[model samples]
Structures are given as structure tokens and as C-alpha cells.
Target: MPSNKAELAVRIAAAQPGDSVRGLFFKTVFSLIQQHAGPAALESVRVDALATNYSDLRTYPVQDFLTLMYRAADVLEATVGPENAVFHACGETGVTRYATGPGMLIFGIISRGDPQKLFAGAQMGYSAAVSYGSREYLSTGPKSGTLRVRRDMLPPAYHEGILTGALKVLGLKGTARAHAHDIDRVDYDIEWG
Candidate 1:
């Protein structure tokens, strides 16, 4: 829906209050910006979002996180073009880093390399990372499923990208198609081989 940073900023400013995200998310987004758009771009985003001192153990308002996300998207678009793909790539990097992190290593081992298992645990992961919203995973068959997310404020491409990244980390090739019902709700139909 929002094709540019200005529109995204307006939407984020009006988002419902009370939700907060783990500061680790800010770091991931900053890393992505620094890698693709350079440190200056990253610094610009941090200043714009007023997120210069984000810490992994703290929580920050979701609005601030959305501002960072929207700003990061703009920088990525400027540097990479093909806006949606860049946002998706940003989401992938976020998930890939988290999945490979020390905290999530046990979940991966417990999943026994099954993407479905990893997907089914998405709600737990999401809960740990944010203070609001919900994620539900539904299995359609042996290699297909749907992920329904509610009340999440992230861009749809980012959510779909998480699904793509999740499958990749589990060594499966998959596709995730986002069906957004609004900014607040989306369902991602996913299949893997």
C-alpha cells in the first residue's frame, strides 16, 4: 500500500500504541542498513528514528521501531532499487541472524531440521521478540502451510520474508505469498520441497 517513506511515516505515526519490540530488532535493522547502504546511511536512519542507543536487553516503542523500519526501507530502496525485494532481503537478514544466534540454536536442534517444526514455533519466537501481536501457523499438507499474523505493524513484505528466511535456515526451498487484509492482518501461504 505505502509505496514511499512519507506514506509509511504517516501510517506509523498513527499506529496503535502500547506495543513494543525488543531492542535487538533495532540492531538487526541497523546492521542491514550499514551493510547495504553504508554507515552514513545507517547513522542517518538512527538519527531519524532517534534510536542511537538501543540495547538488546531493552524494549522500545513499536512506533519507533516502525520508524526505523520505514527509514531503513527508504535507504535500501535508494541503494538497491526494486523496493519490495530490498525490504524482503532486510527481513531475511533479520531472521537469518536471529535463527543462527545463540538463543535460538536450541530450537533449531530440537526442530531436527524440519521447517514445519520451526514454523510452528513462530508464535513463541514472535512473542519473545515483541510485546504485542500474534502469529499462527497452519499446516496444509506435508510440505505446505499458512501463517496468519494479527496486529503486527511490520510491512507485509518483511513478514513474508521471515517465512522465506525460516525455510532457508532449515535447508528447504520454499515460497511465501502474502495476502494482506490490511496493515493489521496478513496471511502467508507457504510451500516447500
Candidate 2:
């Protein structure tokens, strides 16, 4: 997991030319930690954003990724604003914008007015969460789907925010309502205008 995460981090960083954009994610997370949780908490989290300052890709523990997600989400909620949703949009938009190779194919498919492709991309994108797998029902209705993920992993509203924001960025109107049926998976009923 550590090695795979390192490779992915490097791959995402390579979406842009410079190293500064490479670590912008961890850098933003660390800054939020320092501002809200203070230096001690920041130190406890223990991911040095400065490592991304160079043109090299750094490998961080997989736990760091998980921790950052929760902490960053917490910071977003505690800070009070719509800024946290921006995190999702920023990452997705970055990937959509600077994407090359196979990503170009993805963007192309998405450009031809297919909302199902968007959900497919979201399904695959969220799959990056360690070994998590999402089950998406894309053939249900017109530009509508059901995305199911672990209930305990992320707040349902976070997923809703990401869906709405990302779809808006992609020039579609998206709305999500979450339903938790059991202790395992939560279903996000997604519809777009």
C-alpha cells in the first residue's frame, strides 16, 4: 500500500510540470492543520509538506492519506464554509484538466454529454481509497445513478458535496441524497439536471 500510494502521488503530481503543484494537496492539508490544530497536532500528523518543494516525489505512509482525509474534512467542517467541497472539485478538476494519455480518452467520453461516464469516473476515483470498492448503478435512469460506498468511511454529506461540485464543474447539474440501509454500505442516490 505504501509503495502503491507513493506511485500514485507521483503520478498525480506529474499532472503538472512543476513540483510546487505536485504537493499542493498535502501542503494545503498541513496548512489547515497548522492553522486549526496548531503545530503540535500538525507535528503529530507528521507529513512534511516541504518534501514536495523539490522536483521529487515523496512516499508517505498510507495512513497519512487516510488521516489527511478525515482531518481535512474536519477542518472543513470546523472552519465553517463551502470551502471543503472545493477540495474534491479541485482534485477532480485538476485531473480532468491536466489529464493525458488514457485520461484524455476519459475526458473525451465525458465531453460527449454522458453523465454515466462521470459517475464511472467518480467510482474509479474513489476506488483509490486503499482497497475500497464502490458499486455504481449507472443504468437506472436518465443521468442518474446509485453510488454505494462504505458507510463508516466518509460522511454522506461529503460525498454529496463532491458529487454536486464535480458535476457542476463538468457542466452538469448533480444532486445526491444518501441512504444508509445497513452498517456496511451507504447508497448515494444521484440525479442530474
lDDT top scorer = 1
Least accurate 10 contiguous residues by lDDT in model 1: 101-110
Cα lDDT of model 1 by residue, 1-193, tens digit: 3247765765576467778877777788888889888988887877745656888767888888777777776778766556577668767877887776633853567567887787787788887777888899999999999999998868778877878887888888899999988877889999999
- lDDT of candidate 2 at residue 90, scale 0 to 100: 34
lDDT of 2 at 32: 57
Q: RMSD (Cα, Å) of candidate 2? A: 9.5
User: Which pairs clash (backbone N, Cα, C closer than 3 Å) in model 1?
Assistant: none
For candidate 2, write residues 1-193 as lDDT tens digits.
0112343344343232221223334554566567765786666555554333321133343334434555454444444334335345334433443233224444456545476776677555443322343556555687788876652333345456656655665677768787866433578888888
Model 2: lDDT of residue 25: 40
Q: What is the lDDT of residue 49 in candidate 2?
A: 40
In candidate 1, stretches whose alpha carbon ends up further than 4 angstroms from where it belongs are 1-3, 6-14, 102-106
TM-score, cand. 1: 0.88
